[model samples]
Target: MELSFQTVLSQVMLGLNNGVFYAILSLGLAVIFGLLNIVNFVHGALYMLGAYVALLGYTMLGPLLGKPDFHLNYWVALIVAPLVVGLLGIGVERTMLRRLRKFDHLYGLLLTFGLALIIQGVFTNYFNVSGDAYDGKPESLEGAVNLGFMLFPKYRLWVIGISLLVCFATWFVIERTKLGSYLRAGTENPELVKAFGVNVPLMITLTYGYGAALAAFAGVLAAPIYSVSPVMGSEMIITVFAVVVIGGMGSIMGSIITGLLLGMVEGFTKVVYAPASSTVIFLIMVVVLLVKPTGLFGKES
Candidate 1:
């Protein structure tokens, strides 16, 4: 099959859209790992929860509110799902994760893995494994743009733009702002930060909440594009973990850049050789590990 410039451009755009989700999801993982020192295995499940929450919200709102035609829209789900998931993250942190903090890090990983399984299982039991559809797109974002070389979906372009904005805003907060300074300091020396009268525990809790919110936000953005299902995150999270590893867990900007690059690589691979698309990122990861174990942006321990 001969591919034209337009075909390549469109594929690249599609890849960028996938990259936006990867960036957002990996960014959340990096944030949670940076401060909490936990691998957050449940991140994928939390992400899945976010999508389900949006679906449930949209499906239930009308019936519960006694208005048959009045369903919760994507716009509302975009805001509400993250908040709901973030709060659930906070509850998990306060009740479960906090107790295991003093133990080996593996404990936390194990606990979160168990939690992930439980969450996925519950949703699978209720919804069945096939998955649910979220068909609505906001009216304002419902069209396509003729970019001369390619016709691009307006919603996808919006996703790319907004995702970049959110990712950068998050980077700025953690790297430039005063609150970010506090978070960084706490990560380095929690005892000292506490001695300085900072509520390090509360900050940690909030940080986890914030990270979960980021995942949930990604989920909302993804609902229209992907099937809303229990295993959605389970499948994507592995790729995301590779993104985090390649980008390094400690660098927020690294996650964003690596994700976008890998997404494009995967997209390009699809054009060149269709079957290699899924495994390309993992191959890159193996190369990175063999060459620089610290990752592209990670610091040596």
Candidate 2:
């Protein structure tokens, strides 16, 4: 089958749309794992929570409170959902994760995995299992913008821009700044950093919250692109885990580049063989693990 350049570009753009989410989600995973040393299996459920929070904040919240005329707007939902979810993350870190600090990594993973299941179950019982359309797109981003090759939705462009900015800013914060130095120092030697009067436990709590916030941020972005569904995160998380693995756990730049690159690869595969796109990332993950168990950018501990 001969495909035109426009068709190829279109798939590439679609791939990129998917890629941006991968990049953002994986970035969060990397952040949590890098600093906290916890495998956050609940990241996906938190992402779903972000979307539900956005939808309900704008739709059900005002009415439920007998203030039907006062509802959260898209812009407000964008900020509120992440904040609320991040605060919830803070709670989890403080109340649950802190208790497991001295335990094996498997314990943390199991805890988070159970949390994800419980969250997903609760939502699935109450909400539509298939999906719910989110009509939360702001009026300002209602139309498509011409991208020379094609007209793309303004909301998608916004997602692309915002996700990139957040990812890069995070990378810079952790890699370039003085505070980052402290974080790294605390990661390396928390007791020593604590001796310097740095609140190491507080820092760890904040880091986990930040990572959860990142996942929620991605969820809000995705709310418009795809229907809000409980299973949405479960579906995406597996692929994202693959992305994280291929990029190397705890590797920031590696996750970003690998997410984008693999997205493009998945897109190209769709054009070549529709059936293979779904499994291409996993295939790459297998190969990468076979060659370097540590991952592409993951360091040997």
Candidate 3:
């Protein structure tokens, strides 16, 4: 197929959309893995749950509190869904993850896997697995802006910009803040951090909650771009896993940058070679592994 500029630009937009999720989800996964050493297989489910919660909010409260237009209060859902999921994370950490601290890493992985299955199943049972388009879109972000060469959706631009901001904020907090120093210390040696009068267990619990919250936040952002469904996260989660592996678990900045870059690459592939887009990320992962076994930014375990 002959490549056209418009085709490439369209692909880039699609890729940026994918990149938003990858960047956010991978960052959350990296944070949890780095600090708590938990794989958090339930992250995808948590993301789906965020969307569901927003829907629930719309169903119950939007009518009573909505503006004159039928906007359905998505902005409120975007804020509240994550908080609800964060609370759930706290409960999971306290009840399940804390108990597995002394077990093998595989145990944590299996446990989280089971949790994912459970959450997904429950959601599928309640909400049709076939998927439903989000009922609401924020009017504040409606319409498209004319770029020099193309018209870009305002929401799409918001996704890309907000994702970048979130990623950078996460990196800054983890890499440059005093709290981050303690977090790193806890990750390296929880016992020592505890000895230093820190509440290590509490910190670990909060970290997981924060990670889960991040995933849920991504879900809220994603509801408008994609349908809200139980299965929405299933495939994307697998792709993000590959992204995390390629970026390296030890480097938050690596995950952020790699996610966006890969998203753009995937989009370009879709434009030029549609058949190869799905596999392009895996191909990149293979190349990275061959060149750097530990991953692009991952530290040696």
TM-scores of the models, in the given order? 0.97, 0.97, 0.94
lDDT top scorer? 1
| Per-residue accuracy of model 3 over 1-301 as CA lDDT, tens digit each | 6787887987798798788789999999999998778788899999998888777676646466754344447877878888999999999999988898888888888999999999998888888777877767778789998876688889988888887898899889889999999998998988999999998888888889989988998988888888889988777788898998899888888888888889999999887788999999999999988999899987786
Task: Give the TM-score ranking, best first.
Answer: 1, 2, 3
The CA-based lDDT of model 1 is what? 0.90
> Per-residue lDDT for 287 in model 2?
96
lDDT of 2 by residue, 98-188 (tens): 9999989889889999999999999999999889988878899989999888888888888888888998999899889999889888877
Locate the minimum summed-lDDT window of 10 residues in model 1: 128-137
Task: Give a tens-digit lDDT track for model 1, residues 182-234.
Answer: 98998899999999999999999999999899888888888877889999989
Q: What is residue 126's positional error in candidate 3, in angstroms?
A: 1.9
What is residue 104's positional error in candidate 3, in angstroms? 0.4
Cα TM-score of candidate 1: 0.97
List, in order, the clash count of every candidate structure.
Answer: 0, 0, 0
